[model samples]
Target: MKNYQRYTKMFSMPPVRSMDWAEKTCVEKAPVWCSVDLRDGNQALIEPMSLGQKVEFFKLLLKIGFKEIEVGFPAASETEYEFLRTLIENDLIPDDVTVQVLTQAREHIIRKTFEAIKGAKNAIVHVYNSTSVAQREQVFKKSREEILKIAVDGAKLLKKLADEAGENYRFEYSPESFTGTEPEYALEVCNAVLDVWQPTKDRKAIINIPATVENAMPHVFAQQVEYISKNLKFRGNVVLSLHPHNDRGCGVAASEMGLLAGADRVEGTLFGNGERTGNADIVTVAMNLFSQGVDPELDFSFMPEICEKYREFTQMEISPRQPYAGALVFAAFSGSHQDAIAKGMQWRRDKKCEFWTVPYLPIDPADVGREYQTDVIRINSQSGKGGVGFILQENFGVNLPPKFKEAMGYAAKDVSDKTHKELKPDEVYRVFLERFVENRPLFDVSECHFKQLAGGIEATVTVAEQGKKSVVQAVGNGRLDAVSNALKKHFGAAYTLTTYEQHSLGEQSTSKALSFVGVEGDGKTGWGAGIDEDIIQSSFEALCAALNNLFVSRGKD
Candidate 1:
């Protein structure tokens, strides 16, 4: 903070009032996604990937629907040169898929780069030179004309070599560090390179604009991109591209805005893996379009598998909270969030809605191979009744009554709080069984027999309490009421049956019945659940369990 005066804005705004891109709201379609993972991401890694890993990553890129991939700077290292040769010698490059290689605007590097892709069916020989004012003044220490000549001479060499080799190789040029360069000057250099290539509709040339350091905001970059798009020569045949880094954490935003500004392609790495902060995340950029009802043209349906393989090959860890792909991105732990999500899911089931309009979720987790039970509504001390009930209903076919769900939620949360850990679904189920289903510390029912009467039922019940058993009889309007009366008489218990509900656990006729009961006694409500092959038996057990809970609440145990 004290040295803030030492820093100044290095980015230059475009010279014209090019604000047409601001009228667009979102990226309407997918861009030509060219992955630089092997070249940009691999170089950023602490340990660069082996030749085998690079090959596997290339295959992965092909599977993910990339038409253009920058393999590496083949002129930079023996490893890079050998990797390109391997792809060509083994015929690994597909006809439809174009492999791109990078080179500086120098004759030797440009020649070596062309040699590396000799046998490839389709390849883009990408050439770049720094055109930023900082690079000219501090790094290259050259004049503007000298830099323009560098790009033009390299373009001429590319054209000459392709004619001699009789290969229809496409050409791409990048004004490196374009963010720091004057927008008009960068356009001048790109147009000069385009003049040398003289690209046609059949073989369009690429003019890439890179935010090498990301010194400005996304709107500034979008304006600059618009200026270049409108003023560039061979405008119809040029494939306008953007390559953005994440130093300012706006790589994805800048890429999106640049596309809206008429850029046709994006060069990035998966998961934003690159030097410094990393490159723009192609996954995030693509998924952003996918979430907006645009087809991203890439298959991320098995995101977990992709994340695992990416980590294994790169030896990098994916954050648990990474967007769309992290472990916890879809996990809802807050009580309110879980409750809302539970209701939203029920609404979908009831209405059979075709659209994804669920609250608190921009996209359906299931759309990305994640599930509701395990991924959406997770249980913790902060979980609520609806979430607890949802877990039971989804996983175990036990739909708790609304009032009982509150009690169940408290019970599960208490366990999780005491243990200082999140409760798994099975652990929550076990808690339910221990507290509400098999809970009989003071009393148990051995058997019951009923006899019909005029307008009521008479029940003879065998009650076991503190190692003692007794038979008590009472009359009531129904079997459960009759049993309740008998128990109150035998134990002198005071309680009212506040709630009773039952449902079949399965669709089959012989499936077990599940019953829930709630008893209000001593100004408090206690709940219980029971399951049996017979509905009557399950109801009876439910009543007994509820009364037992009441007794414990009243300190009669």
Candidate 2:
């Protein structure tokens, strides 16, 4: 294998032998999506999906409205043969569905692949052999002329076998690495195979051309499609299919470009999970059409469910951030991102599902299996009010007043400055309620609490010394300053009230209020809060909460 790092596919497999140029126009039409999830996907699995897994996956494809699903290479194993038998005996194959199997042109494997397809209401026997010069010279050890005879010989055998078994089987042919094959010879060989099968309109043969190794760019793929679409004598008797891998990480783009070039069908696996790098990501390609207002016609509402089952069956990891179908694909962690998404969601809803245009969003989360809600309440110092408010609304269903939000924003800043990380949702709630909304704390502090030592005057403050107690009373501009000035008096000149404010707290006129105080004790900003039915009492309580906040900031456990 060539260093795939330097090339697209894993190996220097072959160069596409040039084909005779032809002029053909692309005919726009509805696309047929053929899922190769079972075979192509299975090859990439660390532990191949079991027979049960194949059966389950096959059924999922059928249930999702796939009329043609390539079940497996039945001739490859006893287990695969049994799975095909189970699909047949259980009457699971939909009448309109055509069960397909992969096999080489070798008589026995083709016969065996067909044997597994027997008794199906409708079936397709897809036979292929590598025909490129590289295959002939290196892999197959034969000339192109000899490989053509082998392929055509295989087709003849398949035709007789299908007639003998009394099964209605359609023939599909591919030159394994079709893109690398000489175009004139490839068509010559495909035409030779078609002559043996003699396809009628009702049983049109599917000529599946694979960009098997992504040796060329997309426009080249277009030219190849146009080449065959023009030269084929019986266009009505041909179903043009394209199977492109993601070795170049451009499978979806290549597939779309192929469709534009007149491909009638596409073959791919979900999440692009297949052999080396992966197959074309049908989910992304189809959903890309969805975003463009074209009906992808495939319902991916159960996309995550499909992904989960495939991961379990195939034992392949799907990146959490993979496009459209990953766990974190719709998750927003940045504050700006969350804000934009929230606003976009609102605008989309308000436009009556019409006038929505937003940044950083291609499709709505709800279009796939995603929810706009999250447990992400942690807003840090770097966060904005929008993020903090969102967390509060999600976690506590709390509608914060504008001022309260401002206070909590500072609190979050204080915490984040220490931790240097976003505060978790629970932490945000704890800090908000601990300092601002709640009027009372659960316990008494050593330095600050209501006491008889201060005479008839009541007050609260924070003290940091272990087992230390000191009380002082002082007159100040107001009740808040009086209490704060008392803390400075006790803690010495190092501690003092910097600023304080009180506001009416409750719904009724007779209802009391709450207080906020800022102290620069020890030369750092310490803001406190409290609310109660009594304005003065509320002020004292808030001053104590601020003091307690200082204690908390000192790493109190």
Model 2 regions more than 4 Å off: 1-30, 349-352, 375-384, 401-428, 438-557
Q: List, residue by residue over 1-557, the lDDT tens digit for candidate 1.
A: 88999999998888889899999888888999999999999999999999999999999989888999999999999999999999999989888999999999899998898888899999999999999999999999999999999889999999999999999999999999999899999999999999898899999999999999999999999999999999999999999999999999999999999999999999999999999999999999999999999999998888878898899899999999889989999888888888898899889999999888888899998878888778888899999988898899998889999999999999989998999898888988999999998999988899999999997999999999889999999999999999989998998877889999999998899999999999997797888888999898999889888887888887886
Displacement of residue 315 (Cα, Å) in model 1 is 1.1
Worst 10 residues of 2 by lDDT: 13-22
Predicted structure 1: clash tally:
0
**Pairs of residues at least 3 apart in sequence or in different chains that clash in candidate 1:** none
- TM-score attained by model 1: 0.98
How do the residues 8-87 of candidate 2 rate in per-residue lDDT, one tens digit apiece?
Answer: 43222223422222232332334788888888888777788887788888888876678888888999998778888999
- Alpha carbon lDDT of each predicted model: 0.92, 0.72
- Give the clashing pairs for model 2: 505-513, 528-546
List the candidates' TM-scores in order: 0.98, 0.74
Error of 2 at 549 (Å): 6.8
